[model samples]
Target chain A: MILWNIWLTQDYFEKQNTILTYSAVISKAYQKEEVISYEKWSECQNYYTNPENLDFLYSIPVTLAILALREFSDDISRRTET
Target chain B: MSIETIAKAIGSILQDTYSRNYGLSKGFNLMEKEIALSSYHLLMRYADNDEDKNEIIATMIHMLSAPFSDHEIDKITQYVREIFFKQYPDEAKRVWLALIKYSNYKKANPSFYRYQDEDSLNKAEENEEKFVQQISSDKNLTLDLSEISLEKSEAYLLARAFVITPYDTDDKDFSNFLNHILPIVIGDLTKVEDYSYNRTRESRKFHHESISDIEQYLANLFLEANFENSKSIFTTLVNSLSGNAQRQRFGRDDLFEFVSTTLDYFVLKLYDNGNLKIDP
Candidate 1:
């Protein structure tokens, strides 16, 4: 779960700074039917809601990931506005 | 299933998650460049001798070249050269000779300033392209060397002497090809170790040796390349430089002059082919 959070944070940082909009793994996930949305993020939400998807410890990383992404996005937005 | 089962599941989940995200990258190119340079400095601090320094430098270059532009590689190489030159003259010369990236990027911007990020690299590339297009392309300078008729004259003989000429070719065509290639070759010859700086006997000998090496490379390249014009006097020059025929005994200054002229042909060919070397 700690490792998953780190990976998510790294992914967010890469996307925020890069010129590329989409990543291939996300596309591959969608192609494999592991993700169903064009945005490639909808599967995570579905997993969160599904009771059968009970890796309860994984929630810790998932929550931290959401908060970190929000803070990062907010920081970028504030900087851009300034 | 108790604590052991839970730990195993966690480990499995972590491995799966990390594996999925392993190749997710974009901005990492700039990050990778930064890391490579920092690693070089760290390596330099520990490098004991000239051999160790050169081996590490070469390893660093081989590792990072895939992720960076040709210009970026040259920039890093120049930095490494400056650092190595104080202690390792021979190793430095080897590195300088081997660096033959055929781009007008350096000619466009001579500064060795490091780019801060991807934005700056892109901006530098844009500015360089604009500069190169302005300076290089528009001249449209056409040469008609045959009209000069320097046939059998010292200038013609001097130029002709450098040419490999293993096979037969039109004298006029060979002259025209040589005329096209000499300038770029001379520019490169003077770059590694400027012979004019001291004008001493030793420097002249060193320069001559360097030019011979350059000529060997030109010979090798001409034999390797698939030229569009097969019937070109280039074919004759290529065959001569092919080094397959009996090696000609060329003296000091004459060898330098001839190799300089011949290598210029190779240089022009390389420059023309530079467009095909797409950046990462």
Candidate 2:
């Protein structure tokens, strides 16, 4: 049940913040002009293995996602008022 | 009764309830059936134990006012057990494997806006089509390759090079042009180590080892090619660069920029003006 709830939350977060989450994953694994090596790929995957690691990876994207969603809501509300 | 017995009974009841609520009057609706299966799977995943699953099933049977016969309970338990323990786990593993394949493919083809969600991906594709149409369809669109990035210029040149008309890929000189001279012209051979698993790595090494006077060799190869439409432009390019190569004025980046821009302009003219007019 605990695992299921965690998976559901993760899935929900993914649907809501597709760009943010994916960009975070890509940025964590790659940099411009540098090859994405197997070592970098493993490092990104390892972050999802534990709660502490997952928290570290999610922090930035989650913050940005909330800001983006809030901005979208504001834009919609403004358009509706007009 | 065994755990399987209760699960089977519950699974049947769940299926019947789904059919009553979501099934079309004429036949089974595939979309609704999919939703039902996914909902049932989610419920099973959440239950986390046989007892929890069986209790849910028993409660549902009681609420629905359905006859909870012993045989019926046994059959539902069996079906639920098979799905939870066997089928769903296999599906999850299949999904995991596909994700790995997709991740690796993305690493190989690195692009800024290419890796996106479905809507954005479609938008990106549409934008690409618009760009191609704008460039390919317009006859008077004069593109100054200098103003644009090296990537776009390279793409234009390569796109023209790959065309079958006038330039035959099966020809030895054309093959030489692509395999040997093009890398020197493009100036990316030095950064071949930074390419993650590209097919051109071995060919790059071969080109580097075999070619000594790369600039002169590239110019000679271009002149040697019997270009049906752009021979005069190719000759002019060779003539213009020969002095610079002799004086050693052009560096790798300078050579790449000049060659790529010149070729980009040639191809753009081919599409824009519908004629490869010789520049005086």
Candidate 3:
């Protein structure tokens, strides 16, 4: 079960990278006079399919901040509840 | 001589050696040397076979393996040796043979010899200092994220990625839903401070919720959006939040302020790209 979850996380990260790649390509094409090709879009999709690249790309601080905010929110909720 | 007498003789020899060679006023140093000498002496006695030598040797080895301070070593050595060696000349030849054999065995076992060496002792001392420092730095040291289980840490990280991502929807209700869930995602990544009220008074403000709360909320929202179904909107949101947080050391108010600003920036960017519509 744990192994399955880890694999799932890896999958999510890969998909995230695909989105990143697509955005990058679209943005670049917008600035360039050269025509964007379907081949480049396909390349971006291929990059997203690979999970290994996204492992190091995950952020720590954002996670910590979100956790902090969640706690603050909970405290606010508790205060209101009381 | 009896085993007790032999132990006594060894103890006396060590005490005399400590007094004669190392100054007694250096109490800790003298005690440490006494323990080492007594340990060697006990092992020697076991090999001599005044009694069930193997059992005695095993017990002594276990004792030596335990953590011992220099002062405790001195006191314990005195008791161990005195209890073991009481009779002397009659068992003298056996004691000598035991010492020789044991010494030879130790020489052959290089690893064991190294473990009992001064270098190993010094390394143990260094490790003890590091442990003390680690404990001292965070009174709630046991609950610190660095000390948490890897699974929890990873869960927290995943939740964090989910919360910081700005949600965009053509519908107002869905964006509001994402905003509402964001706090729960943040909660899952926090660790509870374990110090007393006075000690952790500062940290108490941080540990109100479990990391899973935020993680589960963000995960569900992401899944609802078919995060994989969309292009890099989710990834960009995670990256933006992470990037901003990394660039600044935020104060208490800064967290809320940063999130608001980040949301505004993303909304503007998405609106310019014609991918998002704002009702304001």
Candidate 4:
């Protein structure tokens, strides 16, 4: 039960954070470039803001990270406890 | 219970639960055993082309493998239609009209069911093609390799080169250093989404002592050299130097050589001139 709870919490955090991080990283990278004018930035931002694109980008990392973290944490805990 | 009954029961339970979850429906199971036998009987009663039979079977299998719910599948279908129809209206319209006619045919005759009758098969192929085209055409989607700042680009490139090299260090310090630096440099280059400073803080724990040792050495060297504002000089030196790339490149012999050469040059400039003194 303790293991399950940890798994759940970590899964939630990873999914929420990865999406936040991905968007933040993309925005920051765009900001770094001088050639991407504010108007162009807004246009690109609007494009990515579409629900399908946002969900697609967000879901990939969330699902991958959750699977990886769950397996890794389970293995570690099993070793330590046994 | 008998073995056949027991096996059937287990299979039924699995089918009810994870079979759908894992994209294995009854049709899929049947199709897997004998490719397009069911579909060919229903869809191509008048047609007898071996290649078409194989193609339809392949498309059916591909659709069955996709992980999507009924609702999500509908959304995907619509999204594909919009993208393809907008971009290549002529071809897209032909495919769209064919799909509509196909859908009507399937709806009108329940007995005419086949693997090829599924709209999802064609929709998946269309979606895959559109995705490839979008990735190829969109310039913004392409990674910007030349945009990296010159001062930091070499360090970033060197860190990448360091990752491919083997390490001999048993000390946790070296492992910790590589773990810390590699991500930051790669993250910067790849426009990776996370740049939280917390990862850096965690990595610093491994080399905290070594960094302090270096800082103390520099402080003493500056003091003995009678450099004015020795404290400020030490602070400036520490501030001006970044450990992110250094730690990433830590275990490489080439990196070790670079650091040694750079340090030797600095020492020669300061101490060989009799400007600095080191107490034994």
DockQ of candidate 3 relative to the true structure: 0.01
Over A3-82, each residue of candidate 3 has an lDDT whose tens digit, in order, gives 99999999887777755655555444533534455455335434434544323333111121122222333442233222
As for candidate 4, its clashing pairs are B39-B114
- What's the CA error at residue B228 for candidate 1, in Å? 4.4
Q: TM-score of A-chain in each prediction?
A: 0.27, 0.28, 0.41, 0.34
lDDT of 2 by residue, B49-159 (tens): 655544443333222222223333333333332343244543222222222222222234444354568887776656643443333223343223232222322221222
Best-matching candidate per TM-score: 1
Candidate 2 structure, TM-score to reference: 0.22
Score residue B136 of candidate 3 by CA lDDT: 24
- The per-residue C-alpha lDDT of model 2 at residue B259 equals 61
Give the least accurate 10-residue stretch of model 1 chain B, judged by summed lDDT: B151-160
Scored against the true structure, residue B231 in model 1 reaches a CA lDDT of 35
Q: DockQ winner between 2 and 3, please give it.
A: 2
Q: For candidate 1, lDDT tens digit of each residue in B1-280? A: 1112222333343333335435543212222232234234433434456555555544432332222333443444444434444344443333322221112224234332567788888888677545433322222323333322222112212222223221123334334545444443443333233445343322222234334433543443464423533234344444433433334354333434565576575666566557665221
lDDT of each: 0.37, 0.36, 0.36, 0.34
What TM-score does each of the candidates earn?
A: 0.23, 0.22, 0.18, 0.19
Better of 2 and 4 by lDDT: 2
Residue B126 local lDDT, model 3: 64
Rate residue A64 of model 1 by lDDT: 19
What is the per-residue lDDT of model 4 for residues A1-82, given as tens digits with 9 covering 90 to 100? Answer: 9999999999878766755665554434433432333343334344444544444334222222222222333442333212
All candidates: DockQ: 0.03, 0.01, 0.01, 0.01
Stretches off by above 4 angstroms in model 3 are A1-82, B1-156, B160-181, B185-252, B275-280
